[model samples]
Target: MPESRRRKAAVQKKRAQENVEIEKNRELKGSPRWWAPLMVGLMLLGLIIVVTAYVTGGNYPIGFDNGNYNLFLGFGVMLVGFLMTMGWK
Candidate 1:
């Protein structure tokens, strides 16, 4: 049986709406060129800081030499990088 003209039109309209939504989503699909590099760098920096603190035993003789505070600083940096991932796509 043939679809009624009104029913066909409604389906077409719905498809058009879906297509528009898909295009809108696509527009938001990519991060800026520097975004990914910055994100990864921050995460790596955090890892390095944490490792340095452990190796130095908080006695590096510079700022952030405190044991627990260095850990907190490293984790805070890592957290920011992780949070950035949520907006990446």
Candidate 2:
């Protein structure tokens, strides 16, 4: 009931709340289950896109096949996406 006691109680409660928040953040960061599957799926999707581009010839001009270039570009984009999904690791 004293003013000093009330202030101390408030401070203690704030500290407890901060501790809980910190723990929650740690649990989230430490979990990799979601990241692993997401990155893999992205990488696979990129591969599919690149393959499709190659098979379609990417509408290259001069009667020459340029699908490989498209494939490489798709792969590059996929790599970046994968890395980003995996936290740039």
Candidate 3:
């Protein structure tokens, strides 16, 4: 092939490869609408539960009869939030 034709072909091939890479990256990117707010809400709710439990001496109805239940529940909620963050962009 002529030198000019070879160069043109190489340029086109490079551009095609770049476009494919860009599309792959776009596909891998996370959803901005769902995970972020959900994660934040989980964390906040966890914190609130923890504080309320602490202030009420674990007597709250949510804890049922055990004072430690709220503590564990709060930590579990917070852990879920942390896990959710991994999916956020």
Candidate 4:
């Protein structure tokens, strides 16, 4: 091939590779619109639950009489929220 043609071909190939990489990155970075908000809400809700339980003397805020279940439940929920955050971009 001529030098000019070779250079043109190389440029085109490079551009095609770049486009493919861009598309792959776009796909990998794609996330639901609600994902981040939901994760933050979950974290906040968990924090609120934990704080409420502590403030209320660990009473059953949801009408149950489990002594310290509320605290554990709050901690569990918070931990789940924290874990979900790891999946966020």
lDDT of each: 0.84, 0.70, 0.87, 0.80
* Better-scoring candidate (TM-score), 2 or 3: 3
Q: lDDT by residue for model 2 over 1-89, one digit each (tens)?
A: 45698898999999999999999987667535677667777787777777677666675322336556666667886986667664722
- How does each model score on TM-score? 0.67, 0.43, 0.68, 0.63
Candidate 4's error at 44, in angstroms?
Answer: 0.6
Q: lDDT: which candidate is best? A: 3
In candidate 3, the residue pairs with backbone N, CA or C atoms under 3 Å apart (3 or more residues apart, or in different chains) clash, namely none
Distance from true location, Cα of 64 in model 3, Å: 2.0
Q: Candidate 4: where is the Cα deviation over 4 Å?
A: 1-28
For candidate 3, which ten residues in a row score worst on lDDT? 58-67
**Ordered list by TM-score, greatest first:** 3, 1, 4, 2
lDDT for residue 12 in candidate 3, whole number 0-100? 97
Off by over 4 Å in 2: 1-29, 59-69, 85-89
Residue 2 lDDT (model 4):
50
Least well predicted 10-residue stretch by lDDT in candidate 1: 58-67
Q: What C-alpha lDDT, on a 0 to 100 scale, does residue 17 get in candidate 2?
A: 100
Q: Distance from true position, residue 59, model 3, in Å?
A: 1.5
